[model samples]
Target: MSSSSLPSSQKQVHLLKRPGRAPLSTEILNVVTAPLPDVSNLASGHVFLKTHFLSLDPSMRPSMDPSKKSYRPPAPLNETFWAGGVGTVIKSNHPEYKEGELVLSSAFGAQEYADMDVAATQRNGFFYKIDPAKGIEPREYLGGLWGTGLAAYLGMKEIAKVKKGDRVLVSGAAGATGGLAIQIARQLGASYIVGVAGGPGKAKYVVEELGADECIDYREANFEKQIASLSDRPEGGMDVYFDNVGGQTLDAALLAMNPNGRIACCGAISGYGGSYEGLKNSFVIVARRLTLQGYIAIGTFWPQDVYQAAIAQLATWLAEKKIATRFHFYEKVGVENFLDALKALFEGKNWGKMLLQVDPEWKGEGSKSAAK
Candidate 1:
């Protein structure tokens, strides 16, 4: 039977064959034989989605490989890769969801549909309704307000306990979450925001484009010295360090943290190859009264006042153009480009959020007018 005619029970998924050193290519053909999904097994409030856009992020790499010493366990050897994604409703067995509505879910099976327990999925506690109105781009919901932006805002504002007049330092300052963290710091009235990126261009963009107070190129041999110099000019030493890259960048931030400073340890992308070593200045935390907290973006803070407050502020910022988002679109959605887009992330090739344009039913206002 044609895919269109196939019952919702027979969901065709793109499966991973095995782990390999070769980059993602069209020839990695391990995908076949997906079982049909049953939404009826899910609870009354639960809903299933037709997969639309799968998020490509740094955390996805470890989830793809079995042998890596990942912070989070990889998905079972031959199963689907689960992560954050937005999808449309194909069948709704629940009252909370209806046919054709879009919702975000963690069910990462690359099939057309997935069944999830309404209360249990997002069991780790983070999901939101995707509104298509309000003039905010659909992509922005995936990028700015939903996942990356939420991580950045929470890490800097809550976990790091950042205060006004504090000098905030963020490494990996050009990536999606890093860029968002920089803006949140500014919005929170941070006295100074310092960003460390891979190259001079990214460093310049961090300061000039992202509105950071200072930017340092971490590729420089004397990067620590530059940070020191910048530290001296303003409020010396960092009061809050929002780190995305671990390793040398982390080491330097540790050395430069002021007394009583706090660090929000979000990810260790530097150790993506699994070669992270002990810090040279591990004792700094004790000596400086520093609070370095490792953060995992999962918790029970659903519909909490803090979450609502942050969302409200972020929406206002976007509507007012006080906060802007940049994105690179991948026009197609097969496994070939899927792997290529992911590889580009590790190479630092994308300037902004990398999005795959699957099911191009909704375009901007121009397309809507033309269709009419």
Candidate 2:
């Protein structure tokens, strides 16, 4: 195959290794530049795609390992690894999709191009068409308005049962989900909001930027005691706890929660390594008669229409500026530094949403035509 005769090739970061319980490394992934694959198997109703941005969450780590049992399918080894992102339809056979339309991607991976079966993806409630008229950035669909927002919103609304005058406490407050949870808690009419973060900077960001009433540094010595010492204590201690990092933080929250408090268990980031220290204060659940429910945003929790309605509400808040979002973008040239960004996430380097901005401007044949 001569270079000119061969199809246009693009970059795809593929799964190379599974780290298991070990630390993440660049060696776990390999960037492969390859020609587009034949999608003739899907005879019709397919479209060519060009991806713009992707969402990187700690949950993706579980997707890389076959034995890990993540919410999404295991990313294929030596094949393009997919992350939820936004893309453009270059050409389409599906009636709902068309040429030059932005879409919430279900199959478009880290690569520059994809052949998506639109009807098939929509059936799974993953593919959504973006209305450019709204003037929303592609990345916004991956942040507080997308799965990131849904997790925070639904967790607070359905599981945490946060109500007006509720004193809400959120762990991992500086992270995308936690950050949004704090803001959403305030918007939900929580009279007092407390964010628990690892360091002073993150704590400050939680209060000063995300609008939490107070942010406690969990790293401080006897931090649980500090949480217990907040002045002007409400009639009841934290009425709701939005838990992200489990283990010690969760234990601390248990000690400070009011009787009958509700706990929304969103994530157990500290326990992802399979070595989380057991919680020492779990007896409070029985003594206080608290409600604790663990959840993931997809499946039983989010019926397609319900999720859409929640996202629409969040969009309204975003437009009204009643709630806001901050993003940490790794805008390296063409997804080349995805591994670096993933490493940064694990190191707690990002203060908000961790996003990958790949190929913002690719001058490939038909690329610009498709994006516009």
Candidate 3:
């Protein structure tokens, strides 16, 4: 499919009601036809992009909640829901933005078109141009390169404040961010990289594919014992902990940190659906002088230097065959499938970043390519 044929309208996902006690319903959200928003009079700094891809993320689940201030605002009832998406500019009122430019933003109601104050919505810089001639795929921007990759790179390098020769432990090591965190730790000269993940296959892949020095299966009945057995002395304790899965995994890391160890609290995918029992090992922070830092990817705190550099390096890694990637594309489906895609994330059924292909150009087995 050529880019010219890509749909140019209000491509949107609608959420009917709150998911009460059970799982969110795919049937509840039905795409409705609405007039394409007129952006001719949009506020300055506001620009519109014809969305090509919509990122499916676990953090978005909390947005469905009716509560007001739980990280992000809840989706308004009976209205079109919003999300992070990448698109090409079909129209622009902002002076700096030109029509036909590609960009990414935190704007929601991820329809085929979006209008927002480009200055307010653009994170890590304005909608970046997507060079279609490059070997890298356009979808990568929504997944590893844009979403999870930035999460891992920023969480480890900046938030965790890692240093060479330090020992690092990563939880949820098979997922996109966790997997990338492992590699970044290794590249930063970590002495040993330990991975904690669910199931045997993930553990094996963490070691084999991600180059983890060791991997512990969290599903094993002797999970704690397995983690304990891998220890030795003062140096045996981890210097950095890159946490993606929370709950037990966090509790376990709190138990293993060396004095003055730092932790990058990226996400708690383990407790994604709802609250879980809080950590019992809270004492460790005081006992070990550990620093726990939490973050969301935005503002000056964002790892722009690391992110842009990594993208360039990632292309090289792919060319040199030093890095590998995997994706679980949920083929061309309608806006109503939003709940199903989100459910797959919370259930851990998805292996990498989940993305919705809103444009026909991205519907096939392969989409646009960037530099490899």
Best by lDDT: 2
lDDT of 2 at 181: 95
Steric collisions counted per model? 1, 0, 14
Question: lDDT per prediction?
Answer: 0.70, 0.78, 0.71
Candidate 3, 1-372: lDDT as tens digits: 233443445546777776644566755555766666656566677776676667787776666775413456677777778777677776667887778666666574557667677666665333566666766666666655665776777787778877889889998888778887888787777888899988888888899989998899999998866654444554577889998877877887787788898999888876656664488889989988899999875445545676567567656765565555556555545454566777776666666566766765543244332111
Q: Write the per-residue lDDT of candidate 2 for residues 55-160, one digit (tens) a residue.
A: 7788777788867667777877888877777777776777878777878865667777778877777675478888878966566777867777888999998788
Which 10-residue window of candidate 2 scores lowest in summed lDDT? 362-371
Scored by lDDT, model 1 comes in at 0.70
Best by TM-score: 2
Instruction: Estimate the overall C-alpha local distance difference test score of candidate 3.
Output: 0.71
The local lDDT score (0 to 100) that residue 130 gets in candidate 1 is: 74
Q: In candidate 2, which residue pairs clash? A: none
For model 3, the stretches where C-alpha displacement exceeds 4 angstroms are 1-11, 27-30, 38-48, 66-69, 123-126, 133-136, 232-235, 300-325, 363-365, 368-372
Error of 3 at 174 (Å): 1.3
TM-score of 2: 0.89
**Model 1 misplaced stretches (Cα beyond 4 Å):** 1-48, 65-71, 115-117, 124-128, 232-235, 301-303, 360-372
